[model samples]
Target: MTATTLHADLLGRQDPQMADVLAGEARRQAGTLQLIAAENFTSPAVLAALGSALVNKYAEGYPGSRYHGGCEYADLAERIATERACALFAAEHANVQPHSGSAAVLAAYAALLRPGDTVLAMGLPYGGHLTHGSPANFSGRWFDFVGYGVDAETGLIDYDEVQQLARAHRPKAVVCGSIAYPRHPEYSAFREIADEVGAYLIADAAHPIGLVAGGAAPSPLPYADVVCATTHKVLRGPRGGMLLCGAELAERIDRAVFPFSQGGAQMNSIAAKAVAFGEAATPAFGSYAHKVVANARTLAGALADQGFAITTGGTDTHLITADPAPLGVDGRAARQRLAAAGMVLDTCALPYGDQRGVRLGTAAVTTQGMGEDEMHRIAVLFGRALREEPSRTRTEVTELALQFPPYGQ
Candidate 1:
């Protein structure tokens, strides 16, 4: 049966309430812009895998070493997922069991570090993820985290300062990644600094791993001692996480993920991740990945033309951080106005100031077949949405979104 029929007829037959919620969400997604950097449209095949019978399985341990019985299919699914992840990222080992990106990072830390160990990563105000070292996060409580910030003038990572920090702090690990930097990190520089200070280089590549998979970004596999990534985002998989490392760290990483951090693999998500990896390996995905970046560049320039202060001038990847102060609004107010106008995005920490900036990406729109011209239109809409009445702007935004339905008509 068709997707609509399955959702409405079958699901509505039993759980009409939840089905209505699901249907409403689907309508909402199709009826509004999804500019969130960390969101994407997974393929129908991937969605099917997520809804597959594998969801019933509960394989507690790794493939061929389960804690429970009747795990043959689960083993096969996990094995395939692990193999595809390793091949897709060019890593010697892969663990496809972490439930989220944070879990993967937790497992990485558990495998390599003890409580109270010193670590270094990007500062929160500089676009670092919460797991990096937020006072509210476990990373800050369990480990002494020394943050490294970007250059105030360039809005880029201060590699020299990073080196200085590493030498002085002598951290056990140095993480190289950010949530809103809008640039590819100098992995080699990080590796060299880590080596100099005898620290392991951990690449929290949750944002860029999909681009790396599609050959749109540089791979951190060659430099990082361990790489933690989300299977979703631009990867277009089910919500999950994975870890990659050399063979020497495989067992340690696996044990950390299984016994220490989590239990019972989500076989369905694992299966879906395999599907996404398989898709990412194709030339079509490579083209899509490049288009994602191209669209973001176009959108950044367009937004800049509309008076938003584009951070770092423009973006090199799917993400863009822009200050809406030129539009007479702060990031929080801008986000509310945009939401009222049917455009969805987030506010992020600005590198130099306490003021927040809007963070957006082209992955979802590009997946819906939007191009450079559409990017320009979206920017125009941004200006009108901020300056004009919300009702009028919302009508145009809905019309634009309907024209590019994320799912087939």
Candidate 2:
């Protein structure tokens, strides 16, 4: 059945209050711009899998070796998910059990290092994820972390600094990934640095994994010893995480995800992830992925024209990080104004300073069938929202969003 039919006939009939909440959220998503770098619209097939009976299963272990009984179908779903993930990413082994990207990173750490072991990763201020060793996170409390920063002038990863840090610290693991960096990571450089220091190369590929699937970004599979990723974002999958590794580490990775970090796997989410993986493997998805990057470049250029200082000058991926300071608003204030105008996004750290910048992506908009033209128009809306009354811009934003319904009426 269609989404509208499901909401009205089943959820609306059973629990009007909860249905109203969901309906409101649906309306908000449909009517507003979703420029959030990590958000996307999952396909109906993926949504169907997420709502399936597999959600009821409590499969606690790997396929064919479950702790609980009556997990045959659950086993099949996980197997298919793993197979597809492996094939798509060209990894020797795939583990599709981690609940989220952070969880996947945790599992990778559990499999590779012990408490107090030193790690080298991008600095949080430079776009590194929390799992990269934020003081508030478990990783920081347990492991000693050395951070690398980007070039102040170029907003690009400073490979020379990374190598120096790796040599000085001799960390147990070298993490390569970021939350807001808009360019493809030089995985080979990271690999070489890790090798020189006798460190394990861990790729926290949460954001770029989708682009990698679509052939729009380089794969970390060949360079990193462990690749951790989210299934959603530009992949258009359900919110979940997975791990890829060589055959030698497969058993350790599985154990880390199952008995160590997570208990029962979410079978329904796994099924949904499998469906997304299947969809991503198609030629159409490849075209869509490339367009995501193209739209982002267009958006970045347009935002620049509107006076936002685009990070890295432009994007090689779907994400774009820009400072709105030139428009007389900081990232936080800019996000608030944009939200009022019905445009949504996030704030991120700037490469060279204590101030933050705005982070946005083209994945959701492109998924809504918006092209480069829409990106340019969206940039114009951004200028209006920050300069004019938000209420006035809100009307125009909603009208534009409604033109390209994420799901058809």
Candidate 3:
């Protein structure tokens, strides 16, 4: 049976409209260039696991000591996910129960800090996530949050400044990671600063967990006190979160994620996460991760040659954050134009800057088996569209996208 037909058989009888929407999204993913740094296309095995019957179970507690019965299968899935997650990142322990990266961060905070403890993290405009220290988020409203930003001319993290802040504030936690920055974090340096100030170091590797697993980026498990990530980003798993730490803090993290922060876990997502971790452990995934970084650098260089100002001058990761002003377009306008041309990405806001920026990534394209050549062509199409030629760029984008259809569809 066809995909649509199978999907219809599953849901069309009860909810034809919802089935149509699902089919529409499937078509969109098959056609568009999904460049969101935090997005990726999962493998078919992962898709099957996500849609599995594991979702029917409700296990409110961890394996072997659940609050409900018939949890044997659920426990098995969670255990497998946890074991694979730990192995993939070389973490001593892994908790695959948190519903999202944000939730995992919250659980870590709950496990380690009180209601009004101090936290030092990069601010939202400075590439940090809302869960890190945005005043609009719970992490901000509950804790006393101090923000640190990158240097102006160099556009690099001011390690000296961070140390100064840590020395002054003596924060309960120091978070290292960013959502829009085009650079890899220095986890060891952050750990040093944390030690100096007696602060717990939380590394939010939500965006590059796959790269870490595949050896394209440094793993934070060896340095950070706690590491949390979303499975759906570069990991190509279901939409869920995983937290990792040393054996000493495993129980604390588990308790925080279970009875304290969230209740029953999403078993389907956990099963899918196990499948993803298994995939990431392979040599082929490692090569794919490296190619993602290479493609990003190539795309950034091509955009720079086409008159776009790349953030931090370049990228060493999957991200290519740039100010679209050089293309005579604002960040929002550039994002809209690109979307109109069938290319998808986000408009970024830089640290302590009013000007808008555009953030591009190569993870999704890499999943489609694309390489540096495709990145160069994507950059060309971006320039063409941003230069007020969406029609021509749209045609080119559609044609090029067909050459590397997502998920091999």
Candidate number achieving the greatest lDDT relative to the actual structure: 2
Q: TM-scores across all candidates?
A: 0.98, 0.99, 0.97
Ranking by lDDT: 2, 1, 3
Q: What tens-digit string does per-residue lDDT give for candidate 1 at 1-409? A: 3334435565887999888887888888889999999999988899889989999988899888899999998899888888888888889999999999999999999999999999999999999999998889999889999999998877989899999999999999999999899999999999999999999999999998889988999999999999999999999899999999999999999999989999898999999999999999999999999999999999999999999999889988999999999899999999999999999999999987878889999999999999999999999999998998877899889999989888777
TM-score of 3: 0.97
Candidate 2, residue 168: CA error in Å?
Answer: 0.5
In terms of lDDT, the poorest run of 10 residues in model 1 is 1-10
RMSD, every candidate, angstroms: 1.1, 1.0, 1.5
The local lDDT score (0 to 100) that residue 359 gets in candidate 3 is 90
- Candidate 3 residue 299 Cα shift, in angstroms, is 0.6
- Give residue 350's error in model 2 in angstroms: 0.9
Q: Would you list the rank order by TM-score, best first? A: 2, 1, 3
Cα lDDT of model 2 by residue, 309-373, tens digit: 99999999999999999999999999999999999999999987777889999999999999999
Q: What is the C-alpha lDDT of each candidate?
A: 0.93, 0.94, 0.88
